[model samples]
Target: MTTLKKTGARLGTLPLAVMVLLAAGCGTQQAGDTVKAYRRSYPTPSTPADFLCPGEDPEPTAATAAATAPSATVPPTDHYAENHGFRVPIPLHGQNRCDGLTVTERVKSALEPLRKRGDFAPQHVQNVLTDLGYPAGKVYQDGPTGVGFLIVIDASPWCVEGTMSRDSTKADAFGGYPDGTGCEPPQGGH
Candidate 1:
């Protein structure tokens, strides 16, 4: 029974000594030393504006200016003036000079010479003319190479046929006529 009491007293003294050693190891002075070491390693950020402002910008940057810049302006098309000139200045109406049968007959007539000269075939010329909106009611015939027309209904003029020739390999096989120049009328009006 005396040995048991001695053992209990030793155990109580052991817990008290352990608590004192723990308190000394984790003392306020030790905590203060830790705080001072932390301050030296990483101080609280002073004057937070140093992080906020890198430097005063002399002028707005490209990124900033682009965000604030005005939108671009698109230019107007010249088609309206071009169409007016085609109609008013260079009238393309009434009987075509090449053949009497409007623009359609004129194309057929023009193709006759070219076909004979082997520059174009009949069927090819017909197909090309059909694709180009043939029988143009408003006549605007010139040389086969320069033949152009405006539809009776529309303002836009189209060069329907003979703007190019197989004979063009040699310079001016069509009687040395300048490109897009008018040809002299054939004798006896054929």
Candidate 2:
């Protein structure tokens, strides 16, 4: 079609004309300036992540040091989680927003006292939730990212979860898991 040919021709040349105008707008050293602008806009991965935040302990934890100790009786345990009780499986619920806010507030109140502990750590979260009448089997615990549990306090579909940062902590309720139970995200990678 004549119209299609006209449109295709415009599309091909439009970009070239715009590029020429843009380069002309550059005051001097057009190619170098464009290259520098592009480089600044799209930074390359010049350095690998160290994973250590500033002011954090550059040294590893005591457990890690013990694992590498020259006097170790055996190699470090491969099933590190067997003794730690890290991932406690729980019933999961799918996403729902109906009762999230109310159940979330309950979770917040329950965590208030524990949060007051000057020495609060992730490990304490599971025990505290269990003491608050949440079903022990229904409470799930993961590593430093705090714990998650179903809102069994009332008829609600929400999972109360907590998270911590170097400077602060937070708790909120989210819609249940993918399979539709109010527990930690399915398969449990925080």
Candidate 3:
């Protein structure tokens, strides 16, 4: 068959334009839609408290401080425990608040979840210390990277009081880890 010459039809750009328009339309979301989508994506975290950034010092709030403060009469258990990822060490001053039995048991319990979480192993060096025994009068505080607390054994000269800072209530200053770098404890005059 002979070819029909001379029809020079122009190609339509409509298909390409439609694709661009569809992309532009879907690119941005409305503010409410964004919020809705965020909620859907994140859901609610299991423990909001656990996720809170251990702000500057990571000290417990006043109420918790009071509860943790050692009293003249030691409780049967002076133990301290937490789900061990890295913990703000119990300050040297706060050491008195923990009864050996309580401290040890609490440490065991605290480490249980951490063990489950696969954080520091229950058999790690720190865990071993607690397992063997914590010196009765020693002090401890978080290590430099602040990943873990360092334990001061036997109330040595290296021993110093935990840093003290004002309480919002003006109830009196409370003890805490001094800010520091490395394995050294925060320096505070006892």
Candidate 4:
């Protein structure tokens, strides 16, 4: 009877151990999925042709763009700052091109110094954008590669995109880039 009781206790622990292992596996899978989705949503820029900023001439050729743009290796990560911390109210209507351009420029200027230093602080970036009267939205950082920073401005009816790379020392802005697309509100609607 003593031997049987010990065997039963061991069996009960086996199920608990299995459950823990399953939970851990699920967490790992979920993290991988999140990283994959982020990469899909915001692809890594290969050349200047892949991105455009206001007042910049279009790339003459893909080859030329690739040759001119500096190359930086960005790593994949499960961590990201999306819809966290700061929240901007979504406007009733979409923003115009001019508004987009204005916010883009402000973001570019704010991040210029950080690019030079080859360091990016998410909170500082957020504050600068918010102070500039622009919806900071969400900022995503790819570890510490200094590959650059991606700022998604989803301020109702308008979602402007901005990217900067410490390696390239360039800040590119996309005003009203996702205008027609069905981009959900960044603030989850006010």
- State which candidate has the highest lDDT: 4
Q: Please give each candidate's TM-score.
A: 0.22, 0.33, 0.25, 0.37
Query: Candidate 1, which segments miss by more than 4 Å at Cα?
Result: 26-29, 46-190
Among the numbered candidates, top TM-score falls to: 4
Q: Write the per-residue lDDT of candidate 4 for residues 127-179, one digit (tens) a residue.
A: 76677666666666656744334455555345554555656434343323222
Overall local distance difference test of candidate 1: 0.39
Q: Which digits, one per residue and each the tens of the lDDT, describe model 2 over residues 62-138?
A: 97444323222244455654332233332222233224444445556666666565325544655666666665434
Ranking by lDDT: 4, 2, 1, 3
Off by over 4 Å in 4: 1-95, 147-156, 169-190
Q: Kindly indicate the candidate among 2 and 4 with the higher lDDT.
A: 4
Candidate 2 wrong stretches, greater than 4 Å = 1-98, 137-155, 164-166, 179-182, 187-190
lDDT of 2 at 47: 23
User: Can you rank all candidates by TM-score, best first?
Assistant: 4, 2, 3, 1
Candidate 3 per-residue lDDT, tens place, 1-190, comes to 1232322221245666788897777746765997898899997843112222212136678986564454423333424422221223333232332333234344445445443544442135355446656432332333321123334444322221221112110111122333432234344332
Question: 100-170 in candidate 1: lDDT tens per residue?
Answer: 11343445555556545654433455454555555433233335543333223122232222332533311
Clash count list over all predictions: 0, 7, 7, 0
Each model's Cα RMSD? 30.6, 15.5, 17.2, 17.7
Question: What's the residue-level lDDT of 60 in candidate 4?
Answer: 47
